[model samples]
Every structure is written in C-alpha cells, then in structure tokens.
Target: FGLTRDIYETDYYRRGGRSFLPIRWMAPESLRDGRFDTLSDVWSFGVLLWEIATLAEQPYQGYGNEEVVHYVRYGNITLERPPNCPEILHKLMRACWTFSPGDRISFRSIVDELVPYENEDFRLNAYYHTQPHSQQETVLTDSNSDEKDLLLVDDNASEQQ
Candidate 1:
C-alpha cells in the first residue's frame, strides 16, 4: 500500500515522507508513481515469503531506499530463492512478484497452492527437517507432481491480454 497522510476527518492522501518506508517491499509501479492496489500487496507478500524462507534476514541488505527502487525498477533485481527453500514455495513467491500488476498471482491462487500442505502434522519446519533428500529431489523432478501443478495455475483468466 502507498503511504497515506490524513487530509480531513475521514479522508487521506497517498503522499508522505519516505523515511520509514521499506522500499524493498514496494512494487516498481508504486515506486515510480505512488500507485498501489492489491497487486502491490501481492508484491510485498512475495518479499515476506522470501523473509520467511531466509529465516527473517533483512531484504536488499545494505541498500538504501532509493538504490533499491532504482535496482528494482530499472535493473529488475528481484529477490532470489533463499537457500534450501522448497521449489514450489519459491515458484509461488515468483508468481507474486511478476513485474506487471495484472500478471501477479491472486491471493486465492496462493491459498489454493498451500491448501494441500495444511494438515496438522504438516508443519513447514518438520517437513523441511524430516523429508529425505531423495524424496525432495523426486518432487522437484516430477513435472506432474502436486507441487508443480500448484504452481502452474492460470491466474490471469480475468485479465485481457
């Protein structure tokens, strides 16, 4: 979401100083023109997922806000998959971070992709620790695997080309 400053009793304007804003979470369009909507939130969610995969490491480490904006807008420096992150989850994060707002995956699609792993015993920590390397490799290699299918949905059905 773009920063807002209260302008009237119940009205707000999307303009503010950038001192506290974390530019790493901002979408390129938002950075360029202060335009934002749900797609911007999707981009931030991708960064949050990256943070989770990296055990909460700071994103765009050592980069200032202006530098991050320039890199993202012009250089297209998206967050890379953290070490040991599951391929399926990293794919979902990439979907969320598509450069075009209309091309980003929907929140509904994200939940659908995650639903298969929602059982009580399906803790991410436990799964990461207990799953054998061979099994992980098999899942990654199988094109028809559930995880791959989960990442392959057509989420742009409503957007015109």
Candidate 2:
C-alpha cells in the first residue's frame, strides 16, 4: 500500500513463483529480475485507470500491502467504472488488465480507443471555454520545490495509507 522497494517475492495465489512490489506506478515486472517493457507499464496504468474511473479513490483503499497484493494476484476486485464512464473506455481498461503477458492489448489499440474519448473531451473542453462561469478556474502549476514537497508528501501519505 505504501512505496517500498522490498520485493514481494511470494506469490499470494500459490502460483509457485516470486512476487514483487509494483514499483511506484509501474508494474510487477519493474521489480522482477528482468526487463520491463511498455506492456507491463500498461498493466500498471490499468490500475490507475480503475482509480480515475472510480472518482479518484485508490484502487484498493483501506487495504494493507499484503491484501492489495492478494487482491491483484487472485483477481478478486471487480473494478466498477463510474455511471457516466463510457463502455468503450471500460473495455479498454479491461483490455489492459488481461492476465497473460503475451495476451495484453497493444498501446496502438489503446490509442485507437482513446482517440475518440479525447475528441469528446476536447469538445467538452471547448464548450466550457466558450461559456462564462462565476469564477475563473485556478490551476496550480507546481515549481521544482513544490514538486519535491509533493513527492515527500505522497511518500508520507502512502505510508499512512
């Protein structure tokens, strides 16, 4: 649940293999004893996709590291997208979660799915830009020191989680 470099070398599913902590936002392969390509990264992104679709709650909030590990290993969590989330996006999210390493969907396919969504997002954005709201939206652009503090805070918060 927190950021740790320690390898989760025991497979929670009894799959008779070593496990590893998902490195930050990367996949299991990032901590494995080999090269981790973009595919593995996609797998990790799938978890983030779940988080975003669920209104920013963590992928498995309130769970300890061991429980999160078990949940991912055994496919226990059924990620439910928010009501307004499109089905195509949900399918793409599921595609990223395909278990077999070789069977996972390609990044190109992901882009194909995302292109339409991005276009829709763009249209919505353009519409919003044309309208006048009561107050101007404020964006906090982080400075280098702010970024460092953010990382530190994230590290601390993750530990607490």
Candidate 3:
C-alpha cells in the first residue's frame, strides 16, 4: 500500500554564485520563503499526477520556468485538468495545489479518497487522451511522498458500482 526512500538531502540549490531551484515542481511557499514540509510535498504530488494523466507530458508545457512562477504567483494559475482525467482525480490534484499549504489535502485524506478505487472491478492503468477513454485503471503515486499515490480515477469514486 506504500513505499519510501531517502531523498538526497540538499538545500535549495547554490553554486557558481548562482541560485538554482526546481521551480517547476516547487510549491508557492518553497518558492516564496524557502519553507518546506509535507504540504509542499503535496504540491509536488499534484504535478506528478498531471504528468501521469498527460502520459508523461511536461507540466506547464509551454511556460518557461519563470513564467510558471509568474502565473502561479500573480495569476493564481495551476495546471489545467487533463482531458482524459476523471473529475475526482482532478479535484484531488487541485486540492494538492492549494496556495495555502494548510488548506492542502493531507496524505491520509488522499488515501481515503483513492481507496475506493482499489477494487478488482476497475482496471488500474491509464492511457493517453488520444486513446479511447472507457478502459481506465484507477489505483496511483508520486515520489518524495510519505504516501503511495495510485490510480487516476473518475466520478465513480463516490459513485462506485
């Protein structure tokens, strides 16, 4: 139901008298004041889900690193839901991307939301948007997480049959 590995411990990047950051995957707080916690990890988790739903497509595909930050900060923009993703999963991703870390869903709540799909009835693999939409598998995960994220899902989440 879960997995964990040691993250190569490092602070925000610094070298050559230049600063580097994984701005694309970083949460607002991390970008703003260098704060980090599991909630920030939640933000990264949302990005991972986007990557999966889009079949490994880049997050914020056309935005430059700086543009990604500008949109998130000034415009309150987040990655749009993938056309092939289910509403519930998109909702979960949105929750993870909430601007306030405290408002973001906890890893435990994510499990509660996703557990309903672990049934043998639903297939567990997701396909590209170009493919037929009916045959989706729902069980999911992201790295750097305390929880094992599994399966993308549909509205059948609470409406499980």
Best-matching candidate per lDDT: 3
lDDT of 3: 0.76
Sorted on lDDT, highest at the top, how do the candidates line up? 3, 1, 2
**Predicted candidate 3 versus true structure: per-residue lDDT over 1-61, tens digit per residue:** 2345424213223334676666777888887767889999999999999889999777777
Model 1: residues >4 Å from true position, as ranges? Answer: 1-19, 120-161
State which candidate, 1 or 2, has the greater TM-score. Answer: 1
lDDT of 1 by residue, 13-111 (tens): 133643445567888888887788888899999999999999987777766556677887764688878999999999999999898888889898898
Cα displacement (Å) at residue 136, model 1: 40
lDDT of 1 at 114: 89
Compared with the true structure, all predictions reach lDDT values of 0.74, 0.60, 0.76
Q: Which candidate, 1 or 3, would have the higher TM-score against the true structure?
A: 3
Which residue pairs overlap in candidate 1's backbone? Answer: none
Off by over 4 Å in 2: 1-35, 74-78, 117-161
What would you estimate as the lDDT of candidate 2? 0.60
